[model samples]
Target: MSLLFVSASRTCRSSFSRQHILLSTSRFQSTQINPEIHQTQNQQTKADYPSSSSSNSSRRYRFYFLSIAAGALIGGAYTFRQSRKYEGLMPEYITNSEQLQRKAMEARPMPPPVTKHITFDEGPRVNFPFKLTLYQYVTCPFCCKVRAYLNYNRIPYDIVEVNSVMRSETKWSIYKKVPILVIENEEIQLNDSSMIISAIESYLRMPTKRFENISKLYQSVVEKDEKGKLSFNYPNKYFLVEPLTNERVDPTKQVQTEKTKDDARDNDATTTTKNVNNQSSPWFFTKFFSKSKSEHKEGLVNIGSGTVTDNETKSITSYNKSSEQYKLERKWREWVDTKFVHTLSPNIYCTLNQSLNTFRWFSQAGDWEQIFPWYQRWIIVYVGAVVMRGVAGRLRKKYNLNDNVRISLYECANEWVKAVGNKNFLGGSQPNLADLNVYGILTAIQGCEAFQDLMSNTKIQPWFERMKHSVEPHFADNRLRATT
Candidate 1:
């Protein structure tokens, strides 16, 4: 996910600029104090004792020497830190991108033949219709969610790396966000993680339906205020539209249900904004997905769970949301989105050193020029580290997180493990959406200190390994399939 962080370099620069004035003021004040002390000592010397002058002189000399020594020590320490090896620092954008691409190309191995399934549980091969191009930040959880969902459904797609700073790739679009998907054949531009997933899923289920018509089902409602400022709202974004009536196939109350849900959502957003930092926008992945996953708690969230008659053929595909299996699915998905995801930011950005290390990993994994440039990498690393360090503190207070963030992470993992209890996955034999979601979120921080600690501390290792084995094959398959 895109972390909402204050610009650390800008903060440091502003602070440095103010230091000059502060230093000048301090020097003038010190001069004023010294003169007063000298005048007082001289008067005392004249009245009481001749030895007072010598004692005052000795004290002044000692104070000057001590100040000099302290300054020298601080200067030496700073010089040592600055002069340390910068050879390992980030390379120029072009060079780094080329190297990374080349390495990926070299390391990628071809998948087995379509006829030859690696595992017995390999689902039926899906022949995707149109080419999909996804623009996203490499480390974004929502982007990862889309990727995981696509891979899980065996859909082939391409990726465009959008510059995190400039975001020039999406400049043409009004909804400025990562995880923008362009369906080439229909020329459809899909935004929002949940909307994208729902639209695509609807298309997949009803392949005979028009792509444009499917896109219309998830259309966002835009309104203008008295000041002419536009506000966009997506209601029942996840519900698939019926083919004939062009209405959302919702199982709940018919009229005004969407409005009620939207109102509740608006209220939640307002509350979250007022309470949480404006930085909460970057955490949209977890919030949106969690809301969708609240189906079990709120009696199903307009998912296509009930049987609907096909207008053209009169065919019906039975889907019962009230089923125990479906309920379990919703439960696990909610747990992953809400509880498990909340632990990530707090633990990964727990401390200054930890945040720095996390950025170092991002510098390696993220797009070279766009996300982490050569010159900007170090600045981002230091600045992002400090920013996240403070952000973690705020998140802890907002979420009521534990004193030790690692404990929170560990507890979350343990909960997942306990839920999986005796089974290989929540899906029993195979990995479910919940399993994939959790695995993908955790995978984002795999190289960081949090992931390592999570593996060592919790009993989630076995299930995590199983998930990796199951999900990785599909990723390799997707990559190799793209080449064809």
Candidate 2:
């Protein structure tokens, strides 16, 4: 099935130039956060993927304990979350038919993103500022998180599907993870789904700053395990890089900003100019980033003067353009990585038949079938199904998930819904990073029995539908690939 799609997609493929790559409503090639987050062969990027485990039990327990604490804080925070009651914004290009088609998608969500042979002459919805390439597995939740962020923002990008079995497509790097985004011009390689989203998001918020400089702020802490294997911990994975006003804005670009201001009036349209919002309030940015988990307290903004304010007071009153919202967004984004994402795999692959069906679905969606030899495809489908079934079993025990699995999934959705409260999204009004993280993670399992159950059983359906309309509008094919 994948072979047929890939073969047909080739006829519609457009080639690219060497200097840059583009992507984003959108990220894939997805999940990495803590080096330990890779415990599940179902490694989730806030969104997660299937995994085969060699990780120690202690680490898993520790991670979940932290996750629980974070989840609790989020549940309480939303009760008084002073956010807006957004009716929700529509993507610039959505059609009435696409909105209606989403109803059917609740029954059967879109398959993992892959380009099918569809005719088109026009380019992608947006042209990204930097040239980027995402090397990914179509089924990975981590990649989906990145894609969710990018595509919703309408950031256009080129993607290369990595065979989960061989991963020859990612041979150029030392890090062999799915969702490795390479910023071609700077030669910066971004690994870990949370880091990728935060980096890109930070860049988007402060476009004038050199990205290489921005990336340096998100340094990783590598530690050798008992057996000498390296585990990476990006303590700031969930935090956005604050757009500090230390750097001066380039004044010369006002002409360009003005020239394109009218063009960028559409809320979600791809913009050629620097984001105008970033320009308006650089000094007011409160550098509230966490350097280590120990010091990773949220709620207070200590900026240039290093003065702290009561988080409760700050939440109620405005401090320049900064809001307690960023912290709130980060907390839930972290939850998706630690607590929420782990629930997906057990639910999706609870039974042998479900596992087989999932692998079959994956085989049909991405270019994996076309990319792999026939024997390889057969092994991936049959062998992968058996392996994931085992992985799911172990994860259930490791995560202490509910026996029914669907209950666990529902609880996870409810947890997020509770955080969102009456707001349109966790970020409110517009979908925030947390909102994108959850949506991207779930998008991976769409069209499956688990997804159908998630929609039917949970209140998440309305928010999910709203997110779907926002991300998969009619102007862009949400099949999620730029012509290579």
Candidate 3:
């Protein structure tokens, strides 16, 4: 199990146990002789026997040397072929200990805060009053959404680009996903794109309160699977619960709670009563919640959808028929999440040409230049391209896409454009959550071949351009940042 090799300029030193060493007076061994050949020579004995013996021995030695040489050549060829096959298929990072230590030594301290704010079309001037750090992968769509949301809201923050392979930047967090958020004082860590956005929005709404405590609003539900692995799940991950107050709860919640208790008590006797009600009329029971004694509420306190109404039963019945604008926004947002987002990676990595084009774009547009040294940049470009090419193929199959993935991408673009239908955005005059979500996902692959092709072949260009112009004013000024 243990091996040590030592080599000098022209010779190798090898040691074997004394039992393994073979000392012989003659070059021939009984095991090495061919029985048939030996018998044939024995039959022709006693005519210059010593000279014949020497000639046979020389031929045997030559064949033994030739066999060894052939094996060496075969093994060398095999190793070279395998090595070339995997030449540039995985990313290579800077592993030099000296370089890492040097960078650490060269790092500077954080500068003092500024009172400047970013101006955007959404509302009044938005300000950054807390320390915020975002850990993300530059090319990821989910990360792109968080970035776009922060930019549009004009909340300034620092971006920490995570190494996709090592992820050394996020080592301190228990949850290993990006874009992770480390908020004020570095004690609060927020995970999941949806949860991060909700938490940030809540924090912005109430700037004076401690955002670090917002984690308690969304309860962490951990479940174990058959394999005995623990999984963390957050219910209503997108919902924000404000601090408890009486006015925040719906009045109808009290009656619903009492009715629910009575129903449970009468369950054994009421089986036929429910059947009688069903027999009397065609109806369905709808789930609606009322104001509760608990301090926390499910969603934004001011939002109508999250609150309990006066006529809770009727309200539940008419929920689907309520607001047309709300329905449309929800539909499109769902489409963006389910349909439009899936088209991106498949189209970008559709072919070998597109794959290289994407990785090359990433090399320029991403944080590679700032994070990686010169030589490592080349490794990312070449290796990332090969890796992405294989990923694109697998994604295509996973999404059950067409052979020409570009067609699916184009169709989705056209669907979105048609839905906009002469309006500036899906929300009519102003862009809504759905518009931002779609635009953010697309902006991630902005300059890549797939985006260019989609713009040219579909009607999404005008809307995309509008989105870019709309968010143009909100970009924060560039500044040096410290990594955590």
Q: Write the per-residue lDDT of candidate 2 for residues 1-484, one digit (tens) a residue.
A: 3223334433533433211121210121123233343233123221331123525666788899999999989866764342211112123112222232223234421232333322223443333367666777787899999988777767666677777776655555535467877676665667799999977765654444466666766666644333333345667776655434454234222111111111112111121111222233332222332110111125333221122323223221232222355556667888998998899899878999999999888877775555677887888889988999999999999999998989999999998899899988776567777889999999899857899988998899999999998776634443544222
Taking the tens digit of each residue's C-alpha lDDT, what string does model 3 give over 262-371? 12112212222223211111111112222222112342122212233222223222323323454466567668867889989988877778778887788666647766
Best by lDDT: 2
Tens-digit lDDT track of model 1 for 99-168: 3223333442222112111221354243346767777766677677777767666676667666565555
Ten residues in sequence with the least summed lDDT for candidate 3: 1-10
| TM-score head-to-head 2 vs 3, winner | 2
Cα lDDT of all candidates, in order? 0.56, 0.60, 0.56
Evaluation by lDDT, superior candidate among 2 and 3: 2
Candidate 3: where are CA atoms >4 Å away? 1-128, 203-208, 223-232, 240-242, 246-324, 480-484
Evaluate model 1: give its TM-score.
0.54
Clashes of each: 2, 35, 2
Q: Give the TM-score of candidate 2.
A: 0.60
> What lDDT is obtained when candidate 3 is compared to the true structure?
0.56
- Write the candidate numbers in order of decreasing lDDT: 2, 3, 1
Give stretches of model 1 more than 4 Å off: 1-124, 221-322, 367-373, 474-484
